[model samples]
Target: MKVKCKSKSAFVQPIGCMMLSIISGMGISPLVLAVPRQVSLHSPEQSAQRQPQKIAQASGTDTPQRSQLIQQANALYSQGDFKGAEENLRQFTKKFPEDAFGHFQLGNVLFQQKKSEEAISAYREAIRLKPKYALAYNASGMVYASQSRWEEAITEYKKALEINPNYGEALTNFALAMWQTNKKDEALSSLEKALNIFKTQNRGEKVNQVERILKEIKTADEPGVS
Candidate 1:
C-alpha cells in the first residue's frame, strides 16, 4: 500500500516493515485475555486505562445514528476516502471522545491513508483514554517502527505485551526489532516464544513469517568468509 503520512519520517528498519507485512497478511484479530497458566513469557495488563465500547453496526438497535456515521466512515475508507474518514472520525471523537474503540478505528483508517502523524496523534489519544488498550500500543508501535524509531517501537510493543502477554503480534514485532538491532540470539528467542504462542492460536501466516526470518538469519550466520 502507498503510505502518505504528513510526517516525512523514513522506515526504521526493513526487517520491521517486512514483519508488519507478514502480520498484515494474517489479518488483525481482536485479542482475548488468556487464562492463567498459559506458560507465556510476557504478561499483559488487564486495565491500563479505558474500557472498550461495543461496536454498534448501522442497523444496531441503539446508537443507530452513530452507527450510520461509523458505517459511512468505513465506506469512505474502503473507497480510499482518507480525508473523508478523517472528517468522520474527528466528528465521531467530538461526539464521543471517551470511545476508545472509535479512536482506535479512526487511527487505523488514518494509518491506512498514510497519515502517520495524524495516526500517531489519534492512537495516542486512544491510549490516553484507554491505557489498558494493548491494541493501541501495538498500533502505535507500528507507526514508530515504520519510521525506523526502533527504540520507540520496541517500547510500544513492550507496553502492548505488558497489557496482554499473549499478544502474538507484539511478541513477533519485538523479536523483529531485536533482529534489526543485531541482537541475533535475542531475536531468535523472541521468535521462538512467538511461535509457541501461535501454535495454540492458529496464527499460521505469522508463524511462517517469523520462521522465514529465522531461517534467513541462520543462513547468514553460517561459518564462512566474513
Candidate 2:
C-alpha cells in the first residue's frame, strides 16, 4: 500500500504508520478499539489522561457532543476527507484543547494532507497536554522520518519508547532511524524488541515484517556487502 504519507527517501520502512489500535497491556483485546470501523465516544480528559487502558472506553456521562465531534472527524478521516476531518477536529480542539487525542488525530489528518509543519505543531500540543502520550510522539517521529530528518525522528521515537516501552510501532521506527544514523547495535536491539512485541501479541504480519527488516539490516552490514 502507498503510505498515507510517503517518505522523501527511497528507503521506505515497512509499516511506518502508527497503528491506532487497542493499546496493549490494557488486558483488552486489540480488537476492542477499532476506530473508523465502529463508533466509540468518551471525554478525552476523563478517559485518556487517567488510564491508557481505558483510552477507548466510553463513560457516556460527559462530553457527548465533543465525543460526537471526534467520531464524525474520525469517520471523515477514514473516508479520505482530510479537509472535513480537519474542520471537525479544529472545532474540537478549539473547544477542548486539553484533549490530547483530538490534537493527535488532527495531526494525523494534517500529516495525511502533507502539512508536515502543522502536523508537528498539533503533535507537540498533544505532547504538551499529555507528556506521556506515546502515540503523539510516535506520530511526530513518523513525520520527521518522512522528511528524512533522522536525528529528529530518532529523538522523538526514543521519547515515545521511554514513555511506552511496549509500543511496537515506535520501536520499529526508532530502529529504522537508528540504522540511518549507523547505530547498528542499537538498531538491532530495538528491532529485536519490536519483533518480540509482535510475536507476543500474535500479530503474525508484523512479526514477518520485522523479521524481513532484520534480515535486510544484517545483510546490508555484512562484511562484503554495501
Candidate 3:
C-alpha cells in the first residue's frame, strides 16, 4: 500500500504475488499445465500477485463441453494470451452467467490485461453469484491494490479473511494496505500472521519472502535506522 523507512525493495513481490494462491478453490487441474510449474500446492496465502496462473478444474457435475471450454481458456491464460483467454471466458460467462467461477476467471484475465475496473466488475459479479466467494474478494482487493486504492483493497481483503480466516495471500496484502495507511503495527501483525500461515503450509518460498519483509519492517522501526 504505502512505504517508508527503506528502499522497500527488500521484500517486494513480483507484481504483488497476485498469489492467486487463493486460486485453490477454483478447481485447477493438470489440463492447463502450460504454466511454468513453480512449487507444488502448499497452502493458501502463499501469495496473490506472485502466484502462477491457476485455471479452474471442472467439478463432478460439470458438462464435458463446459470443462473443455475452461481448459482452453486456461491454456490461453498460461500461454500469456490474456486477450484470447478473455474472449474465451467471455463466451463462457455469456453461456453460464450464473456460474461464479466463469466470472472469476474472466476477472483474472481482465486483471492481467490491466483492465482494473473491468476486473473489479467481474469479481463483483462473481461475489454476487457466490456471496461466500473468498477468492473473488481477494482478487478484487488485488485490483484495488494495483491502483494504489489501499482503503478499498483493505476492505476487500477483510471480506476475504472473514470468509476464510486462514487466507494467507489476503493477510499479506492486507498488511501492505495497512502499511500504506500508516498503520505500521497492524501491518507488521498481519505479515506475522501471514508468515506463520506459510510456514505451517511448508511453503518455503513464501516463508522466506515474508521473513524478509518482517526483518525489514523490524529494522525500519529500530532507533536510527533510516
Candidate 4:
C-alpha cells in the first residue's frame, strides 16, 4: 500500500504515499513465534499508520455519508480509540455490507484491537466482496504471521503478489515468513527483489530497511558464521 506522509494535523493522518510491501511461498507452520533471521514480520504501528490513507483512497467512490463515517472511524483509529473505531466500522459495514473497503477498514480496526480472528474474518469478507483485494490478502497474511502460521502467511502473501507483483509490503512480509520457516535462501532472494522494487519506487525508508535485512541474512549465511 502507498502512504503519503502529511504534516502533523489534529486528526491522525493516513499513511503517506509511501509504499509498503510483503513476501512469498513457504511451508511448515509452527505454533510458537518464529523469529525471522532478519527483519520482523509486521508492525502494528505501521499498520495503524497506513489505515487512514488506504481507507481514504479506497473510499473515493463511496457515498458521502459512508465516506464520512469511514473518515470518522479512521480518525478514531489513528487516535487509538479502538473501541470507537470498531463501533463506527461495525455500523459502517452494517450499512454497506457490499462495500469491500468498509470491510477492509473494519479489519484494520479489529487488528488494532488485537482481535486477530475477527480481523481475519473482516479481511476475508473484504476479499470475498472484492476478489482481487490484494491488500486484504496482505493484511490477513499478517494476522497469520502474528499467530506463527508461517505457511498460511506465505500463502496470503503469495496471493497478494500474484495480484500485484511489485507489492513491496507483501514481498517483504513474504521474505520474513520464509526466513521464519527456515528458508533463509529463499527469504534472501525475495528480499533482494523487494529491495530493488523499493529502490525503483524511491521508497528510501523501505529500501534502507530491506538493505539492512539483506545484510543481516548475508552475514549469517557467510561460512563459519552463526
Candidate 2's TM-score reads 0.75
lDDT tens string, model 1, 73-111?
A: 767766777788779878988887776667887888777
RMSD value for candidate 3: 7.1
Rank list by TM-score: 3, 2, 1, 4
Query: CA lDDT of 56 in candidate 3?
Result: 33
lDDT of 3 by residue, 40-148 (tens): 5545543332132332333332566776777788788888898999999999888777777778878888877789899899989988877877778888887787676
When summed lDDT is taken over every stretch of 10 residues in candidate 4, the lowest stretch is 26-35
Q: TM-score for every candidate vs. truth?
A: 0.74, 0.75, 0.76, 0.73
What digit string (tens of lDDT, one per residue) describes model 2 on residues 10-123? Answer: 454332233212111111121122243253433222232335323433433236677688678867866878899899989988987767667877887787788989999998
Please state the error at residue 44 of candidate 3 in Å.
Answer: 6.2
Off by over 4 Å in 1: 1-20, 23-51, 55-62, 223-226
> What value does the lDDT take at residue 73 in candidate 3?
88
Native-to-model Cα distance after best TM-score fit, residue 205 in candidate 3, in Å: 0.9
Candidate 3: which stretches are off by over 4 Å?
1-61, 221-226
Question: Per-residue lDDT tens digits of candidate 4, residues 46-123?
Answer: 342344335545666456687678668757866778799889989988988877777877887777667889989998
